[model samples]
Target chain A: MTLTEKVLARASGKAHVQPGDNVWVNVDVLMTHDVCGPGTIGVFKREFGQHAKVWDQSKVVIIPDHYIFTADSMSNRNVDILRSFVHEQKLPYFYDVIDDPTGEWKFDASKGQLERQYGSNYTGVCHTTLPWKGHTRPGEILFGTDSHTCMAGAFNQFATGIGNTDAGFILGTGKLLIKVPETMRFFLEGALPLGVMAKDVILHVIGEIGFDGATYRAMQWEGPGVYSLSMDDRMTIANMAIEAGGKNGIFPCDQKTLDYVNERVAENGTKSEFEPVEIDAAQVFSYDKVFDLSKLEPTVACHPDPGNRKLAKELEHIHLDRAYIGSCTGGKTSDFLAFAEVVRGKTVKIDTVGVPATTKVVRELKEILWGGQSVWQILQSAGVQLTENASCAACLGGPVDTFGRLNKPMKCISATNRNFPGRMGNKESEVFLASPYTVAASALTGRITDPRTFMS
Target chain B: MAHTVTSPVYVVRDNIDTDQIIPAQYLTLVPTIAEEYVKLGSYALIGLPDALYPKRFISEGDISTPYKIVIAGRNFGCGSSREHAPIALGAAGVEAVVADGFARIFFRNCVATGEVYPYDSPVRLCDVLHTGDVATLDFDVDTLTVGGTVYSLKPLGEVRPVIDAGGIFNFARQSGMIAGEAPSH
Candidate 1:
């Protein structure tokens, strides 16, 4: 049996579940957030005819990360919906916030108000919150209401996002249907060539497989690539598994994963050693699929869609007006480390936007890049616009705005997942999706260029 | 009721998104009827916000030659899940949108509101609706017709009857069943 079947079996207390089988499995974890949460709870209540025994309230995670600043009125209204739901459900585990109690930050109340309005507390963003806060463990299936919920697959678990209607259905029944998808193993071999990060590998795979190639299949990554890449990089790849029509994308538990989890939850006394799941050697696979790391280079998915991919070397002569790298997809520690290593001493050209995931990432990268741990000073000298605390702004267009078509169509190299038309800041501005390293290289050069030049 | 009509049809290119079908800017401004919504939103969809959108179906985009029906190419309705796409199409006075493909979710939603109908064969479609010809469909959310004529297509193979009964909520009541009491899955 495949690892997916085995994992499902282990979680469901069954030996195996078939393609056509319908098993009544209890939900292990239930997650909802922000705009959709209120309406979903409302619908769940209406559907069940009354408040029944919830499968487990403790497992319910409600994080509000979308409308962070309440900068726009629409976001404020959305926050109102979340507040109403949090109060109605009396939910407690809603993390993802920046509120500090002391007067050292008087505006903390304003930030707290934003959190109360949006339903986040002194925790953090949802995707980073669940795993970072030690809630997730191996050998479990988690269901969330966000499309990017598949990010949990990086922790070696099966996770998928359902629509609001499906979420309501699950919330009411504590059960959901699954057609135990067949598994597809991606055995990547060879040390990654210079400048090619995990993000590039996944983008190349998507380009080869098309956006929906792995539809209804669980993509399991087991190879030399898994060991070299960091957890954050693994997440960036797995998060977009849904876009490829994958049920989930996962990597097996390794020492790096165990150590990372152990350090964070060590004080919580949480054990990091999970009953690691192993693949059966007898299972007949596609025989074996191999990708040569030496042949692969940095890739860019030209805008209008994520599937419009091409090698960065192919677009070497192309010019760029923006370089963005911050979102749930590529916004993590190692993404910045790879980026700073590319742009540390080099000066960024004018009109470049280099944003990390959080203020924390910015501080780390600033120290790495500017040699002062304060990025603003080095960025001011480097002329790279830095927007801190505006998380997801590089990808989302509320604060750290990208290009507007009115002002000469801007061509950008972004680390965000989707590159759909009008997705960046402009309907006409061309956005190129690439790894963080590729984006950082473009920022320094003022155009779309390959990152292999800077790598050792 | 068994409905049948044969007509030639007009054709639309695929990859039309929901935002194009009905720009969010026009949802509140225009009248809610499918015809007016179509009149107001169709131009914006074809990337002609100033020209054909506010006016009636006149340009080549709205070819009125052989018939009034429309047959679209692949992956129709590819953007946001706003209910406005079907609303605008139905209100824009469009009779039907016969596509080789449709977004699974949007198609399901459209089937619920009785604004559009899905058909398989090109014979019955071409009989009453010619390629590039303007066609009209009188859709009942259960049955659709070309130029006020119903095309003869077999009963739905396997979409939930709920979508046909004006969406899940309405279908539940119309099936002589009460809410909070759906039959076992």
Candidate 2:
């Protein structure tokens, strides 16, 4: 049995657990959003005749990341109710839209001027902040109320999304049922060319694996090639693991991971030392897998379904009207730097949208734009729009973006998580999920083009 | 193989998410909604003088949500698979859920997360579902109806076999799927 198998088995409490066994692994971390939090709390008191907290306070995390601007009075009320609950419990972490007057939140909306009720400044998409602060470790199980909770799996842990009830028990008692997931090994081989990115790789994987093929499974990305990828790159891959129903996407701890941990520690006041990664003994992994990255050129998963994938070269004379980069996947400094490196001095021929999750990301982008980076100059010269202070704005269609008098059926290549129908603002519009480099190249060529082709 | 609960189940709107079913702030309240664990959590804090959001926080004794079937609008389970919803609903004394539609992923969560009965109505619109009617869900046929509208929900399938055997874990224990070698796929 491999480490994953052992953890799954132990978490599920089986005498001996094996692959393909479905058990509800105990949730190590549970989180929620305002829209859902209020209703969940309402049900808790209505049902259990009391508050449900009898479990570990350290384990459950709550963040009202979405609808920060208070979509309406009702939405605002919801955020408020969730906030009070977090304050009362003193749950180790709670990122609210309005910070307390006393000032103790990780991100204070009060600090920002434009951080409106539903503005982008309060909290980022839960996925962005979880991994950003080093709350996610390598091998622990994490369950988030949001679908993108699978993003934490970048640390080689089994992370997945769960509904509120599952979160309730994990919050009430330290246990929940879990299914032993079948391991789907995706072998990465050969170094990715300079222009291609992990987003492209993941999108390509999604295209091949199909939207529902890997549902409820663990995607273990391996091969020496994977090690070459940076932690940000790995995060991009793991972030969307949920697209295919996989529990989490993971990569082993290596030098890149160490660097990420070191940098994160220095940035935040958390412990600087890297805790030894936990390994699960007594577990076996399914060998069901696939490979062929050298042949795997940069790719995109097109509209309606993430499963609708095609290589950039497959679509001829592809003209993209919009290219968006910035989700938790593409918002990191590395993604921007990579895009800057590729599109240096080159202006976007098509309209572009760059949305970052955090103020820091915005600040970093501003520096790049003002620092005479070619990409920045080109973006300014071009009509690219930057929608700042929105969480999953472009990814989930919160109207953070609007193009004036554009064609009805707009086609965009983005570096977000899912490309499901209407995931982006335009339901009729076609969206192709891909890497930042691919998006930059697509922006330049007006169609999906091989990112490598644009390289110097 | 069947773990039977009471007959008439409480119906609910589709997508009664973990958050709605069990608010995150209240999760740590410990034995009483009236008591704040430490500081007022977000839900309560909203009622505070300085709330980031509106002040519609549910004060203690805001009419306990009556345990009955909740008839919801279409595309009910259209969000993350937060187990809190179902668990809270179950804890709230909801016998069964009846919805015109359910999010596909959340449907599976109902059966896996707890022992509650999740029934889908076949009718396009569960127009009959009122706020307080009892929801009777028949897992045997995988059907749910409130005030006469039947919901068409998918069967739990593999999960159903375990549920029939009285929860997946219990079923696994009885069948020795974990004790012995894994059953052949």
Candidate 3:
């Protein structure tokens, strides 16, 4: 059996399981954010009775990330609904956005967007916060309301996204009925060349297989290249498993995984014991593919769809009006480090925006130095407009005033995931999705660019 | 579960993602709320680019759509796991969607929520149908008729009973997977 099969089998208390076996698996952690939390809570109340409590408060995590920074009343009301639900159920894992005594959603537009944070209780994107807050564990079944919840699979777990209805059922039952997906093995070997990142690799894979390539299957990354990537890089790759219609994307847990999980868990003061599962020797993969990471160049997913693949160098003629670096996929410390390396001491030709994925990442940007200057200072000097608060600002194109959102029909090069039409605000606007290096280079030139021009 | 749905069809190209089905900016409207559910339907498919799609799926200031079926190319309802995609369509009175393929999560949401019937056509239906064309879907034989041409649809198989019973919760109750009766939405 593959690692996914083993993890599901153990979670279901079964001695053995196969690809197509439908079983009821115990859920270790269930997450919902502001977008889906209120709806899920409503379904829970309607189906389980208005007075019913959640099955287990400790295992339920609620993060208010999307649309939190906006002033939209409906968005604010949604967060309040989550707050009341958390208070009612005594759920301890809620990261709230409103800290006023009245519990009213408030934002100070007078302050810089970065300084407009409500309080420290607020985290940013849920996918990044899951690992940062130590909610992700190996061999655990993590279900979230957001599609990007598959990002947690990088921690060597069975993680997938479900809609509010399924989440509502899990809230009352602590169990989910799921079928064991067949595994599609991706054997990545060789080291990635400089200027190419995990985003490029996944974009390449998605392009090769098309968007629905791995539908109804688990994508398992293996070989030496998978081990060589940092935990952040692994997270970036695993975050986009759904782009290729994958049920989940998993990697074999090693010392790096153990070390990162242990550090975060210790810092969080949450005690969790989980067994790491490995692919059985007799395991058979339904599909197998390999990528030679060393030969990869900076890649991009052109506008309209993520699978519309193109090399960054091949699209230098595509002019852009703006550049953005933020989201659960690209707004990490590692991604910023890569971006700063290219944009350091250089001015941007286009309007460039930088948003950290979390409040912790916000601090890291101010503390982490490059060439005697902090990343924050370097980015500021390079003319990148950095937001003060760490939230998913404009990544999903929240409200009209959302920072960095494209309100007009203009072209942009972004480090975020998904280039679907209207994904970043305006329907007619085009987005070129690329790595931080590529985005940084493009910000400098005002056109799609290859990072190698700025590197070495 | 024998029924027939006849209505005007809205045609779209391949990869009609969830963002196009329901944009992220309007996601704040929770579908469980009675009024917001209708409000969500008002904005269904509003994300389609004006140049590509000249016709709107749901007209301005209207809560429900005139079209009951949506014909699409490959990979319909892709991107994002927002159940709002299916909910928005269902709230807009979309009874069925026929496409060459579907994204995994969106299709699951359609069945789990009992919002709409997701049907797969052996051929690309979008190529054969137009936005204003009339289409009739017969649930009994799993066939869609458009302009006197009949096309066979992939059977719902194991999931038919669930949709017939109005979603997973009710199906689970009937199948003994859980206790209690289905709630009235």
**Top lDDT hit:** 3
Best of the two (1, 3) by DockQ? 3
List interface RMSDs for the candidates, in order.
Answer: 7.0, 11.5, 0.8
Task: Provide per-model DockQ scores.
Answer: 0.12, 0.12, 0.86
Model 1 chain B weakest lDDT span, ten residues long? B44-53
Q: Which RMSD values do the candidates have, in order?
A: 6.9, 10.5, 1.3
Best by DockQ: 3
Task: Give the alpha carbon lDDT tens digit for every residue of A1-456 in model 3.
Answer: 898999999999999999989999999999999999999998899889999989998899999988877767888888889888888888889889866423877555556465657686888899999999999988889999988999998999999999999999999999998989999988999999999999998999889888888888898989999999999999999998898889999989999999999998999976568788876788889988888999999999998888899999999999999999999999999999999999999999999999899988888999988778899999999999998678788878888877888999999899998888999999999998999999999999999999999988
Structure candidate 3, residue pairs in collision: A113-A388, A114-A387, A114-A388, A114-A389
DockQ of 1: 0.12
Clash count per candidate: 33, 95, 4
Considering chain A alone, report the TM-score of candidate 2 relative to the true chain A.
0.85
Q: Evaluated with TM-score, which candidate comes out highest?
A: 3
Shares of reference contacts reproduced by the candidates, in order, are: 0.00, 0.22, 0.85
